[model samples]
Target: MAQNILINDLPLEIFIKILKEVDGVSLGKCRRVCKKWRDGIDGSDQIWHEVCRKEFKHSSEIAKRKAGNICRWYHIYKNLKMWIDITTFDKKVREFYKFSLHDKSHALDVDYGVLPLKDAKGVVFYDMSNLKYIPVAISETNCCKVTNNDHVSVILTKTGLYVQKCVDSNGVTEGFFKAENFVLSGEVIYFHNGTRAGELLLYRLSSQKKGPMSRPIFDTLAILPEGKFAVQLDVCERKNGPLIIASTFFEIILVEYDFFPHEQEPKCSFPVNKLTMYKRLLRLKDRLQSS
Candidate 1:
């Protein structure tokens, strides 16, 4: 029987060179091959930095600088593979810029990108890719919130929710659900229904392929106080699973969904304010009395 040449047995310079040539996904696989490979791959910051630059050329220099300051380039690349909705405003004008969450770079180049614009009249969808903008009429009385995911773009107004295919000219589908704020997290879309103080609605898109035909799952994930509103919503992927974090003016809520053996409902921690400390103590006293 002939023995194969082990990867670790190869010269260090040659191994590094070989790893540098492969894509980020392949580099990850190579790390699990052996301890020697792992150390060699992990220790070299330059390799990962180069990979970050190549993979996320669409990102901005500011994002690159920020990521380099925080952690390894690989960490930045892995975390920022998804688009993060970042809003920026000038003296009086507010605009939303899609940024790489990890590196804080613009998700697309200056010319070819989806630019979401808003005004008092309605929400405007700008196709920088084609140098065209479409004004979507919502409600004149209420503000409209717009969000785009991998498959479609959603516009939420006080009276209805509108959705259109990201890559098509299909007319928008209007659903009668007044929303205050909305965000897209992976395949699931999260929105606050009713007023500022409303319920958190979760709508999971079936598949990326059949996006237009995919209907919302119509599941209510959580409920909030009458006055409290969700100011921010984002998904953080972790070792355990994906964490859905919704932040309100009064509190921040974190929900973790884990379905290993069987499908389980998401576990949520809400109103993580100082009041919760007192509430926990009061609950413990009640339990002690019962015991």
Candidate 2:
């Protein structure tokens, strides 16, 4: 009898060590090298779960850049598909389990703009394409909002804030207020995409609850933006007001009224498109503060 020789077969222990260095998918691919490697792949389910979370974050970041309803649908679905492919176990990833990409697109923006994001709890993924009073909680079949502590806010349709407590899935809402006047900008609630002056309320903040009992309040930070441009500028703390963040074809004027101290008079005006004057005011403030 001739002695049999085998090659390209690394010990499972050795391959497991190597697998630790590579990602779950790559590890899955590595398993194809031989039966021994394939066996190790089964033990790495935790890696696959981690990959799922990473994919979700990556998809959220990508979705934020797109604008408008049509653009959002195009971008979000496209990216979701890409993320699905990123998984080694694509078949196991159900479409129903994943969130939609275009929940808060060009649907409704009273005054300001918000980008976009899928709806999730404990983490606000608001679309910042436009501004609205109600932070919409939506699905393809139904839509609602979580307004107050009860987590069962309902729409009044007549158009205005309606406040009341309830025991239901709809969430509590601030009902007795005006909608057109109560325009929102990421202040009280952290929408993943809306702009409220200079404040970016995206993190999970531990809020101190106040009133009757010192209960920690969890009402999402609601930064109501005064619909006027100059008003919004007043809220921004930048010395020259808010920095005009612009892109190639688009323009934004950050009103500086918010950043300048109440007693100080503006030395120069900053037009919506030009910002050179704003730079001087900032430098002047720095000098004054330093001196």
TM-score of each: 0.33, 0.21
Model 2 sits at a Cα RMSD from the real structure of: 22.7
Q: Report the lDDT tens digits of candidate 2 across residue range 1-291.
A: 996645336665565555556654565477688775565565654433344345445543333222212122223333344332222221111111123332322122211122112233211223222111223333322112222211222222123333333322254322344342232222242222223532312222234544686744332212223331111111111211221221111112221122223423234432321122123223322332332
- Candidates' lDDT values, in order? 0.44, 0.29
Candidate 1 lDDT (Cα, whole model)? 0.44
Best by TM-score: 1
Relative to the true structure, candidate 2 reaches a TM of 0.21
Which residue pairs in model 1 clash with each other?
A: 60-105
Please identify model 2 stretches exceeding 4 Å from their true place: 1-17, 23-26, 48-291
Per-residue alpha-carbon lDDT of candidate 1 for residues 1-291, written as tens digits (9 for 90 to 100): 999997768998888888878888888888898788899998886777777777766453334432222234665555454322111111111122222222211121111123333333332343321224433333232334544433444545455555444322256422334556766554466777555455556553432245578554545555554664455654433222233445554344444433221322234322232123223223322332332
